[model samples]
Target: MYEIIFNLHSFLAYIVLAILGIALINAILGLTGKKDFTLEKDFRISLFALILSHLQLLVGLVLYFVSARGFSAIQEFGMGGLTSAARLLAVEHPFINILALVFITIGWSKHKNLMEASRKFKTIAIFYGIGLLLILSRLPWSQWF
Candidate 1:
């Protein structure tokens, strides 16, 4: 069960990151060009990115609870006792990812409330770009790739 969830989470991370990147790029282009926020493409891309990210967050939360390198590591080694690698997995990754999701969610909500196309694009670009950076920063690169 743990392995399945772990693999799923890993696989989904790639998809989520790709979609998020596309969405961010699209948003930036729309903002810079002052393009109309079309429902067909613009809305769909942002919505897809938002949904995928939320799903990834859910799977990650489950993995955190079940994986030995996650909460178990923190339990086994007290906060201060954990090595840098251990701390990254047991603390930094999960916490920062959660915060990243919050930013994405906020961006989605804020974009919806606004009537201006430029503002909507700007909000998504800024928020999702930050979230993407946060996720990239805390990824366990040694273990993952």
Candidate 2:
């Protein structure tokens, strides 16, 4: 179960990052060109990113409960026993990833309430950009790649 969830989490991370990058670039182009926010493309891209990110969050949550590097590490080590890598997997990665999702959610919600294309683009750019940065910062890059 742990291996399955972990693999799912890892696989989904790539999808989430790709969607986010596409959304971010689209948002930037919309903002810079002062173009209309079309429902067909812009909205769909952002929505896809949002959905993929949420799925990742759910997978990570499950992995946390079942993986030895997750809750079990905390149980066995009592916090101090967690090596830096263990702590990254059990705490930092999950927590920051959730935070990134929150920011993405906020961006999606805020964009819906806005009527102006520029405003919507700005909201997405700021929120999604921040979320992307946070996720990148916490990724177990060394372990993952």
Candidate 3:
């Protein structure tokens, strides 16, 4: 169970990263080019990125609960006793990812309510950019490589 979930979470991370990156780049282009926010391209990519990110978060939550490298390590060793690597997996990664998701969600919501294309592009650029940075900052880069 743990292995299946762990693998799923890892696989999902790659997809999430790629889509989110593309979304961010799309947003940046829309803003710079002063392009109208099209449902076909701009909106679809952002929504896809948002949905995929939510899925990744759900899978990660399950992995966190079940994996020894996640919450179990915290429970077994306590917070202070965990090595930096253990703390990175058990604490930092989950917390940062959740916060990133919140930013992404806010971006999605705000984009929907905005009347102007510029505002929509700007909203996604700022919020999704922040979310992407946050996720990148705490990822277990060593493990991924």
- Over 9-125, each residue of candidate 2 has an lDDT whose tens digit, in order, gives 899989999999999999999999999999999999999999999988988888888888888889999888888999998889888988998999999999999999999999999
Q: List the residue pairs that clash in candidate 1.
A: none
TM-score of 1: 0.97
State, as a TM-score between 0 and 1, how close model 3 is to the true structure.
Answer: 0.98
TM-score of each: 0.97, 0.97, 0.98
Q: Pick the candidate with the highest TM-score.
A: 3
Task: Assess the local accuracy of residue 37 in candidate 1 as a C-alpha lDDT between 0 and 100.
Answer: 98
List the candidates ranked by lDDT, beginning with the highest: 3, 1, 2
Segments in model 3 whose C-alpha atoms lie over 4 Å from true places: none
- Alpha-carbon error at 42 in model 1, in Å? 0.7
lDDT of 3 by residue, 1-145 (tens): 8889989999999999999999999999999999999999999999999999999999999999888988889889999999999999999999999999999999999999999999999999999999999999999999899
CA lDDT, every model vs. true structure: 0.95, 0.92, 0.96
The C-alpha local distance difference test score for the whole of candidate 1 amounts to 0.95
Better of 2 and 3 by lDDT: 3
Preferred candidate (TM-score higher): 1 or 3: 3
